[model samples]
Structures are given as C-alpha cells and as structure tokens.
Target: MNLPNILTLSRIVAIPVIIFLFLTGNPVAQWFAFALYVIAAITDFFDGALARRMNAVSPLGRMLDPIADKLLVGALLIAFAFAGSFTTGLTWAAIAIMMREIAVSGLREHLGSEGVTVHVTAIAKYKTMTQLIALGAMLVVPLVPGLELAAHGLVWLAAVLTVYTGVEYFMKAWPHLSGAKV
Candidate 1:
C-alpha cells in the first residue's frame, strides 16, 4: 500500500495497455507504447530508490518489483517477436531470451525451496537494460525505416548475455541441485 509498492504495481498495470497500443498497428499507438514502456522502466529505478530513501520498503514491493520487470520485458519481447517489423533472426533471438528467462525463473524457484539463494550478476542487469532498449527501438521500427536492423543487433547482444547469465546461475545452483556440496 506504500508509494514504492504502488509504483511497482503500476509497472505491471502498464503492460496490458502497452499490448493494446502495439496491437493497434497505428504509428501513433506504437510510439505511445514505446513512451509508456520507457516510463515503466524508469519507474523501476525510482521505486527501488524511493523505497530506500523514504523507508517505505515492504515485502510486497520486493516481491513485485522483479516480477514487474520480467513481465514488462517478456511482454514487449513477445510483441516484437510477432510484429511485422521484426526479422526472422530477431524472432529466434527473442525465443532464446524468453527460454532463458523461464529456465532461470524455474531454477531460482527450486533453489529457493532448498534455501539456496542466487544473486543477480552485473551482466544480467546489463542484459535487462539491453533488452529494454532493443524492445523500445523495435517498437519504433514501423515509424523509422532501417531501425529494425539495429534492434536485431541489440537483440542478439542481449541474447548472448542472457545465455551467459543463465549458465552462470545454473553453475551456482549445481552443487545444491546435486546435493554433493550442500
């Protein structure tokens, strides 16, 4: 119920509206979707900082923040995957990214059940940032010619990082998973 938690919830709420805008296929609607996405991404930063600064942190805020981020990126990635401006290569890259996200989420949940914690690495944070940028630029490709190619490059970069981070997380959980070192 605090401001920090509310901002985190707002990010999730924005996803369906972004989907609606993208589905419209109008140039203005796509652009508005990109704007809304940027706003949502910016709120990720503010919400965390505000929670610390205002001492408004709560269990709900911590739990919802990452979920909001994942949902936003996942939704935008899927939209770009099926959208006309996306390339065949971008679709494959999107598929890889989504797979990695899902695998890591499941792995984390299993580890959490075992009382094992996995921390987000610096590269993973960069991957998230690159993903957000790639999706945002891809959204604008319909309005700006030749931008789809750039977005494709960004997607590939994110894909590489995504795979790397997923592998790193897997390694972290390996011993616990096998019960050899726990």
Candidate 2:
C-alpha cells in the first residue's frame, strides 16, 4: 500500500487503542489516548493531501479515508458518552453529530450508487476540523481544568455545524432523491 493509504489504515487501527486508553480511568492512559488521537487526526488531513500531492490516490484510499474518520469520531464519542464525559444537556450535541454522520453517510452511499457524486463541502471540512479540536479539548479536560468550558463551547459549535451541513447535504440530495433531473 502507498503511504497515504497506510496512514488511513493506521487511523482505523488506532480507534480501539484510543478508546481503551481513554476508558482506563487512568490519567496517564487518558493522556496517551489524547496524544494518539491527535496524531490520528493529523494523519486524517495529511493522508488525503499526501495522496493528491504524490498522485497516489486510489479507490481503496478514497473508500477507507472517510470510513476511518467516521469510526474514529463516532467510536470516541460513544466511549466518551459511556464514560460520562458529557453532561446531560451536552449529550444531545454528541448525539446530533453522530446522527448527522450516519444520515450523511447513507445519503452519500445512495447517491454514489446512482452515479451521482456529492463532493465534500468546505464547510464540512471545517466541521470535521472543529469536531476533532472539540474532542481533543474534551479528552484533555481532566488534565487541564481550565479547558472544560471552552471544550463544551467547542462541542456546541461543532454540533451547529453538523446540523447545518446535514441540512445542506440533504437539500443537495433531495432533487436526486426525488428522481428529478439534477
């Protein structure tokens, strides 16, 4: 496999380790998980960029990259939910993000099968970057008490973007979904 593809694979492989470490109830392990997660998130950006830069993009990489992203974000959010990392009011934010991911994925798959491509929008890229940053802040709250409020704010921000992008994607897919000409 090429380096870009390898990087994408590494992110998927890191999912379980990150969740396990974060769930260990130990500060050191949690920090380790956060560090690993940061690395994985960075790779998420670089993998696609490197693939394009090196002309190493492939079908396998294209398929696996988004899957890896969804897994890393969704799995960690669930782990955090189980760990009671989110307050009752904030839990809905996490749920919203996860639900949007699921819905968008299904929409993308359905459209792909119909020979229609839905490109990732710039706002969606910002949404993902905000999500990773928000999660990173949330994960390190135990190590840095000052980050708690900021972390919560970031989560809310990410949720807003999640919903907005979800609606945007749905609107774009609606005409196609209704079997009307694009």
How good is model 1 by TM-score?
0.93
Tens-digit per-residue lDDT, 27-93, candidate 2: 9999999999999999999999999999999999999998998998899889889999899867999
> Which 10-residue span in candidate 2 carries the lowest summed lDDT?
137-146
Per model, state how many residue pairs clash.
0, 0
Instruction: List the global CA lDDT of all models.
Output: 0.84, 0.93
Give the residue spans of candidate 1 off by over 4 A.
Answer: none
The C-alpha TM-scores of every prediction are 0.93, 0.98
Please list the residue runs of candidate 2 whose C-alpha ends up more than 4 Å from where it truly belongs after superposition. Answer: none
Clashing pairs in 1: none
